[model samples]
Target: MSPRNPMNARKQRIDDLAASSVVVDDAGTVDEAPGVSLIASAWRRLRRDPVFLLGAAITGLFILVAIIAPWIAPHDPDARLLIDQVSRQSNPIPGPQAGFPLGGDDRGRDLLSRLIVGSRQTLLVGVAATLLGLLGGLILGILAGAFGGAVDSFVMRAVDVMLSIPSLLLAVSIAALARQPSQWTVIIAIAVVQIPIFARLLRGSMLAQRSSDHVLAARALGVKRSAIIFRHMVPNSLGPVIVQSTLVLATSIIDAAALSFLGLGNPDDAKPEWGQMLGQAQQYIQDYPHLAIYPALCIVFVALGFTLMGESLREALDPKSRR
Candidate 1:
């Protein structure tokens, strides 16, 4: 019909090709490929927040230091040198032996080396205590929130009793009662103090989530109570829990250090732990300032790292921030 008008002819040809094209069904769902893209997205969001980015970077550096301390430390953490025994007096000359890059403690042990090794113990105690607290809190919180009756009353009252007791006081009492507070003992003490806070936070979050529309829908669908609580409820409630856990980690580190400083932590001869190092350095603060300075700096940096990471996580997990 007049050569099918040139444009119409092209359109007809495209339609014919489309009609002949094969249709492949996509069975693959979005959930099937949760990959590095999610992490990349998270990193991008973190980059947008300068405070969060700085915190994450510092945290990552500390973790790397903890991992590689064995190789990176310049000298034996426990190595004691008596070559300059007479130079123990704080000399203003800053001798090679006396003023090490970070200087030596009164005992002649390398402060830098001890700081490096000490990170391991501090991180171990913090992470372990946080995990133990998390496990105890999760179960108690979930039960109280999901059931919401006698279980809730009992759990909340127990939490109240714990809250009434100051955390530091409780940790101190437990540490003293244990006779000798080993690493594990410190971990247990910290966890015990942390559990009440975790339980309360988790229970409150769970209670809030329990009344959400998705929860109501799951209930209406006749899903088993356990499944509703664990699968549907817990996952949704993890946002705040994760944020709180990070903060708790920082707190645990400080608590561990405090215990060690107070002689409620590692043995006197234990390999370089930050708290123990601080305790040792305190005696020589005026004579060898570097001894105290290095260890104290380590604590500050590690604590700052955890604090930043916690803030970032809190912001990321917040629903308002997401919007």
Candidate 2:
């Protein structure tokens, strides 16, 4: 064969390389790169783990129900019906005429509506408390871990003290001190109770990441300490923090519900809260079992969703767990 031109040979080589390379067309931008597609790769890995898939599905369902509660709930959560009142008073049998698919509360509110609304309240409290705790903990924990000395000792000792106190008792005391326990009060109480947990987890994570080569190199490059700690160190150490935060959310919700059940939460007349409903249902337990059964199931299902999701996330994110 005749010798090929240098340019032709180069063109053929380039075409062959292009044929083997991965091409990603995102919107109008064409990217020819050799990297795993995020969705496909994630789906493949998740499909290999049945437990993780189940957890993800449950978590997603709970989130969907929470977001669409108002539209999906059959009765107006605030609406009161005469049938509901009679049903609550008469120890009536469970049926559609009772104005409740589940049953009515002592106040004649629809149990299902209340449960739907309660999901929103529980999720709100859990997320708000977790975020607040995570923010405060990450800052203090990273500061303590990255700069180990008197600061570390002082912060950890404080954490130890907080950890020693029973979280429920501390929340109760705080709630009692507050003249009126509003939603914000409950959130704050939960956040305060959870701070030590997040702080301890984040502190340990930061301590581990601080010795990593990237962190050492960043320090060697004379990056500002604040930037190194917050921008670099915190981000790198967030895997465990994210997993812990998820678990904390489940615990916070349960704790908040417990506080409400104990009458240390939003006022008694508030629309619907799982804990409050559970507390109210106690009076009518024998008469209308569904009233309590439904809300208890809600709490169980939601708590289970969060627990499963947290476990899945922990396994996915933690190197130790992966092995």
Candidate 3:
């Protein structure tokens, strides 16, 4: 009989340990458990997290409002309902009326209707940016992680350079460079800003997987490299990336609002957007700060929702959090 390779013996040992499964709890103690599925464990943890529940609720409500904006908005967002009450000098805006619970903006547009309807644009921009960014990152990250050496080094350097610039600054720069500043401009700029983040995240996760016992075992068993990467490594590396996407979704909304506020977003005042509304209110801010306050609050609460969910997801997915 041929003598066994020592490297093969080591791989087999590691493989056996991985198969038995090592579970770590918050106390930092590890225990052996067989047939433990990570997805099940993470889902169970998420179900019990109040933070995740709250985030989900807020996100769900935002989506609901966006979907039903047209039907639910009490007043026409584009109508100058209280124009008579608005005067740049004496009365910058109108106080809340019987129907207009939130009052009227400087332009005499119903603030409540604008707020309700604006959710659609916010949802569209945030979701579109996040999807595009995630797609771009997946392509770049996969190329770098699956093919190491020069490919990995080059990608990492670019990612590092992008990371050196603050996210909002990069987003602002990209948005400002647009020839025609619109919602699409906001979406694209935010997407571009997020690409390096997702790329670095995915690549780092994949790299960590390189030393995992399952990967080593797959190599020992002569599994095809492509299968080892896409089927095993990439899928496992997606947890953190998924969680990051939720957080990016929140950032995308804020960035969109900022771009609009800076006069780099949709130039049409007729279009109802939280950012645009906030920007228009700046001139009358001293006398009628409510215009800026409402939209700002909307942006803040919505962003907080996604952030909470993302943080909860991170905690739930961590191996140490398992019992």
Clashing pairs in 1: none
TM per candidate comes to: 0.81, 0.82, 0.85
User: Would you list the C-alpha lDDT of every candidate in the order shown?
Assistant: 0.80, 0.78, 0.90
**CA deviation > 4 Å runs, candidate 1:** 1-44, 82-99, 321-323
Candidate 3 TM-score, true structure as reference: 0.85
Question: Over the stretch 65-94, how does candidate 1's per-residue lDDT look in tens digits?
Answer: 888989998888787653354264454223
The parts of candidate 3 lying over 4 Å away from their true place are 1-36, 220-222, 321-323
Task: Give RMSD (Å) of candidate 1 vs. truth.
Answer: 8.4
- How well is each residue in 1-323 modelled by candidate 2, as lDDT tens digits? 98889999999999998889666665386669777753455455656777776767877887788889889887887766534345534545344454466755555557677788778887888899899988889877986888999999999999999889999999888788888877778889988988888888888988888889988998899999889888888887787888888788888888888888888888844567788777776776885677778777877777787787778767765546663
Candidates 2 and 3 compared by TM-score, better number: 3
For every model shown, the clashing-pair count is: 0, 0, 0
Q: CA lDDT of 245 in candidate 1?
A: 89
Q: Candidate 1, residue 17: CA error in Å?
A: 40
Candidate number achieving the greatest lDDT relative to the actual structure: 3
